[model samples]
Target: MSFSSLLASSQNHLTPDTNNSLTYTLSELSSLPSTSAQFDVDGAYRLLSTGGFDAGKFEEGIAEMDVGERTAQTQNLETFLEARHSAFINLSLKRSQELSAAMASNLTKASRASSWSAEKKRLQTSLLGSRTYQPPPSSPSHTLVVPSTPGLHASTWSANQSFPPLTPSTSTLSQTTLGATPANKVLWGASRTLDSHAHLHYRHTILNETSTPPDTCPGYLDLLSILETVSPNDLATTSLTWLAEQQRSIFQTFVSQKVTSSSTPITSTDFQEYTTSHNITSWHKVWLALRSSLIPQALTTISTITPPSPVLLTRLKTGSGKIGYGTGDIYRTLIGKLLDFENIQGDSPGISNTEDYIFARLHRLTRGGTVRAKKEDLEGLKEEVLSWGVKYFGNVWSFGLPLFCAGGFEEGISAIKESDEKGNVRAVSLAIVAGRRGLVSREFYEEVVVMYCRSIEGGSPRIAMEYLGEVGRERRKEHVKKLILSTRAYAELAGVVGDDGERVGNEGESTPIDLLFGQGEVRDILRECGDALGREGGGGTDAAELYAMAGEYGRVIEVVNKELAVRVDSFKNGVEDPQRNYWKIAAYNFAEKHLNQGRTHVIERLEREDNLKAGSTFQLLMNLTAFFDKFMEGKFGESWTVLDSLGLLPRTAGEVSNCVDNFFSLDKVARDCMGRVVVAGMECLFNLHASLKQDKSQAAGLTQQGSAGGQSLAQQANIDHDKAMRDIRDRGRLIVTFAGLLHGSLGGEVAKLIARMEAYMM
Candidate 1:
């Protein structure tokens, strides 16, 4: 609450009585609540002026208003304001601290010196203010009565309520004697010495959190006492909720234990009873039935012995919290995707009646629809355009257009349709909408589709692509293909729209053939965009992403392969690239990204079935990806085995010549990729060779120093070492052969590496 509001609350304290004299009325004001934190000066002064509490202070029967006495009342008002301000600041400090600082103190106080409680009490009183509690005069014997401050009795507490009792015989109250309460509950009391006012102190801290020096009543007695504070209905409801939560918690624990340990499965209890109590009968029985059916299958998993400390973690959430597990997004997104939403069908159900949901999806999609939005954020925004062709009409389209503009999809078809819909849309668009329901024929689509795209506010040809995309399957591919070629002519005329330097436009208007338009590509228009996204500074598979969109799957492999080659091309063979593991993931997994999967599969099938050249290239990419995956996992032995199987690392003299012949005959792109592969293969061989020699030397020394058994083991080791060394030398022959066969800088580099390996062999 604001300072003004706190002061304004004082108005509720008293009513003006014109008949009362100043002295008697002043005495009445003294009876007000001690919590003068809500005292309002204007309210009190107005009442005084109207004879609510005498017109002036210290006047008694004097007819004239005394200025000096009035000044004292003004000082008192300042004091009241100070008290409220100080109290508010102190409260703010404590509240902010309670969030984190209270957790800072270890479970218990470090020191238990006698002065600890006294000092804490002094600190609380100084910060919060001096509380003067007067024991009710009617309390039982031995309770001291502390006089209450004048004028602070309005409604702080009723006079009839009993004061917090204390053992006046002792100087300090034992924490153990206090009644049980929840961890969060608080009780306030002040201590005063009948000896003097100077010793008075207020305390706020409870017995160092969690460590309650025990001596409480029986557990049931404590619960009964606590329940006395709650009404019957509230108590019943709270108890039911607590019981349900406990059951759920136990069930979760059982599931966790069964999943991660050799714990026995929980018995088949009637869990539906608990759910039915709360009316959540939707899937409780089904879940129980499934559990019963699957128990035998789950037995192997549950009974399997495993290491401890493993847990099937709870669902991950953003921040220190997460949205409930069940409310996951129902619709998949399309923002940066290269394909349309197909009917594999897990689309989120959006009711046309839900204006807010529709608007929310639109608000994000059209704006985040820009070229530069983060892919993750864009993934969510893609769910928006799914609302398109769904009951969107009239003000909904027009109203959402500007928001779409702000989001940067200004030249989008929806924006164009919204602007055109008034005459062009309300009638023509609605006709198409009606036609979509079989109200119109194929002729209707051919008639307005072109004019419809042209008539939209911008007359953007790219809008034609979106409209054609809405056509039935037979026309969709052909219509979109022809339109993609048409966009090339308009590409030059279409200027960028947004802010200076930003891919500009407003009201969701972007330049001609923006990457955001239908399934996110415009072919000939994308040619420039694809080139622009190509790996700058020789990094990333972004170029490959666009190629996948434009049906240039081969080009996608080439682009991604270039990055992979650079990433795997070590300064020294077998030494992994300095780039992080994610670089490899992006390059190798490029085919699996959104919208590319189905298209990638199509290309894979075609390449394997008919396209020999592309098929070899795709197979090579798969080989390189597999080799590096093992290499990056620190599994050099497995990586070498992969390279060997692919014939990149030949073991025999005849195999070496065959590998070299195959390498030299490949296309330039394939050759460039192979050159890196061979280099990495050599480095890995050298790494293995060097490590083997070290282990053999250690075994030789151990054998010379040990018993006859050690001599026998050493003889076996020497035989294995000779055989492994011969295999290593055979693989190295490929590098040496390439050096003499190809007289280039690469051969010279290879020749130098072979000489270093020879020294290690010696």
Candidate 2:
């Protein structure tokens, strides 16, 4: 017979007979009998099918069971879909008959049970959903039999087979209810029982009549689409229904694990709240590329009480899930709902019940600054919050008051330490709390002080500065500076911190830096600021002073040199502008300030720098200053000793190379004025040479006037003239070598000055 006809005939071919018998196929009959062959028509038909029929491994499974136990079974939908598509083949050529007509009937009945139930499930879905939904049966089942060839009558078939009694359960279950047994959970086409995990008959994947979303991970759902299509009226009913199903499944799983009732119950609240990157935030367009969208609408819809009602929002906001930081008006709404605020007194008084403390503390925390209240009233209110905290030390809800109170500071610190030891990640909260009561102490408070400071540094430092006065005066100074520096409040740190440690700027945000840091501490802070600013393209004259005050004379000189280099073009043109001398004057003022502090601190600063050549920075500063003074005074020769060392006046071939090397070796900020330094050095040499030649001519005139008396003076003066003239020749060589070395580097303006220096040599 054909496979489909065999399957159909197998469905009801057996009869109930007391005497059991086994029928083997021609192949099996020819071999030695192995364990008296039992009958399973369902298994035989599946093994004979052409298509992937019953590919669920059902044939392999039912074929193994004894006739007495293999009567009928059913399946649950999720499990049926899980196994239905699996490719299973049985190559064994053995064919057998059904044990009884009941077993034969129930097997097909099991497959039929889930086919229709799954139909009800797919009815609402439109797009993609769980891949586990039962696929349409690829091979149709039938009830009629057809033979492939001319067949013999019943006599031949009867000789080959015998019927057996049906299983006891086969008699118990009718056709439709056949799959209601406890085993239905394990196989296809079975229904869920009371013992199953889900209490809900099905998880609804539909939002409305026209809209059915995929059964997706909770976060992936298009929540706004759900809200918009939810008819506005149904939001009341469906808003949190998903959560109920989720919580029920959790409870069932907890029970199934055999956890005792006395153990901590696993509720939905116990899990960390679900948040997603795809979340739509509140009404504000926080950014152009990213912003809050439907969150405000969802919050308002769920929280409003006018028409649709706020039964859901009230539960979430008033209960543990306060999605506000996301709070202020949120807490006010919730707290107002919880209390008769009109009855609570806010005067200079104390508390009697928990309601009094709750209202007073929450009000102070959320609205104290905005509301109109007397000074004594606010102070007395905060004091009461602290008093109430002592009364209920373990009441974590009112920690607001105890955090600012020094009375129980030691206990609070201990609790924070214990939390850290337990590996609990309460970082942001612990930091804000530590920052508020900014005290550090030894003895009872000593052990916790470091942990508190560390926690403060680790978490939201922005939350701590409000009550900064509570910190010990001595510790506050250092801690405040660290907070400023770490936050990169460089501009604020640059503001003059006086000897008394008060900041000079009027910016209220930087009041901590001003109030807590003294000049001594600020010197170090400024040094770091100067370096950071210098790297980010020179911090200008202000940055130079920062370096100067920090005793980093090299950077001080480097910055001022760069600053004065900016004015080199104007200086070369001999432009008579006061502004041209700005950085030059700045360098002088810094030097005088150093002198006023005792000695010019350049020598001391240079001594500390191990990498430096001891006098290089000091010489740069001295030459830069003296060059500024004497060049302005038309007395370049007076400053020539220091000026030559500034890498400006190279007098030999080797000196030119050294000058170029030093120019490249300096940082970009320090390189800014190098070309100007060269131009200025050339001009100074021409002027110094002229000054020496003029002195030589005056000595000649003196020698001619007083032959005997001025003879020795003129001889000594001519000796000096010969030496100075030789130096001028080397200076001329340097000018030519530099013009070649600098090629195109010194732009059009400095190129003209170098050309003039070469022409002067001619």
Q: Residue by residue across 465-544, what tens digits does model 1's lDDT show?
A: 44553455555545544454344333332333121112233345554334334433344434444554453343244444
Per-candidate clash tally: 27, 8
- Each prediction's TM-score against the native? 0.31, 0.31
Q: Which segments of candidate 1 are over 4 A away from where they belong?
A: 1-522, 527-542, 570-583, 587-601, 604-612, 625-635, 673-676, 709-719, 745-748
- Weakest lDDT window of 10 consecutive positions for candidate 1: 309-318
What TM-score does prediction 1 earn? 0.31
Best by lDDT: 2
Estimate the lDDT of model 2.
0.37
Per-residue lDDT of candidate 2, residues 331-419 (tens digit): 23333332211223322122222222333333232211333343344344435545434223332312322232212333443443453
lDDT of 1: 0.37
